[model samples]
Target: MKKFNITVNGNQYEVEVEEIKDSSTSAPRIQHQAPVAAPQPSAPTAPKVEAKKPVVTNGAGSVKAPMPGTINDIKVTEGQAVKAGEVLVILEAMKMENEIMSPADGIVKQIAVAKGASVSSGDVLVVVQ
Candidate 1:
């Protein structure tokens, strides 16, 4: 009888075996084998990230967001004349297209949010003068 201990998958196992031989049989042959290990692939590297600064608007006629949403489009450009209640920016919030209208007749002075940009409530969208 022969006893052996083997390790597999971080576990240890004990086993026993019995040997049989016939009187007419020749001597047993011995063979050697080497254990093989599978190759491991390396992990993927993450992309580099950079910090962004907050946008600040200090204009007296700045148009601000009413709710958190993504900017879908800018209807008016800088120096473009706009009327009160005219849609100046398209904001997508709660899966709805929200039209950001001009508060009064004015000219667009500056735009703060870009298309597809996420915005917070009260974030500046455009400056009117």
Candidate 2:
């Protein structure tokens, strides 16, 4: 026999369980036990709110990969004029193609990653200014 303390819906209970090993046809017995003392109420706590840090870049107008992936395609070349939200690179991660977009309207100043190159999260893909 084993004894245990259990809580259900904030109510406390004491329980006893017995193991049956006999192969003969039989039903396990159950006994009702007295309820334990109610637990003390705890002070409620405020939910924790975490502040998100802005993405850090190597330089102004630098675009980086958000996750580890292969550079599937390069949509903009160096010296090309681009607008904010322009897709500059197609990154293949977890079998999905993710478009790397320009963060602001600018001219493509440099290509930091080449097509078919593997990159990690935060790796610079292009620099525009």
Best by lDDT: 2
The TM-score measured for candidate 2 stands at 0.55
lDDT of 1 at 107: 94
What are the per-residue Cα lDDT tens digits for candidate 2 across 47-126?
89864333345667888888999999999989999987778889999999987788778899999998899999989999
The TM-score values for the models, in the order shown, are 0.54, 0.55
lDDT of each: 0.78, 0.86
**Per-residue lDDT of 39 in model 2:** 71
Model 1: lDDT to the true structure: 0.78
Model 2 residue 15 lDDT?
94
lDDT of 1 by residue, 1-129 (tens): 686666678455565554776567666655433443434449866879764222333558788888899999999889999887778889999999988888778899999989999999999899888
Off by over 4 Å in 2: 1-58
Model 1 clash count equals 0
Off by more than 4 A, model 1? 1-59
Q: Give Cα distance to truth, residue 78, candidate 1, Å.
A: 0.3
lDDT, model 2, position 122: 89
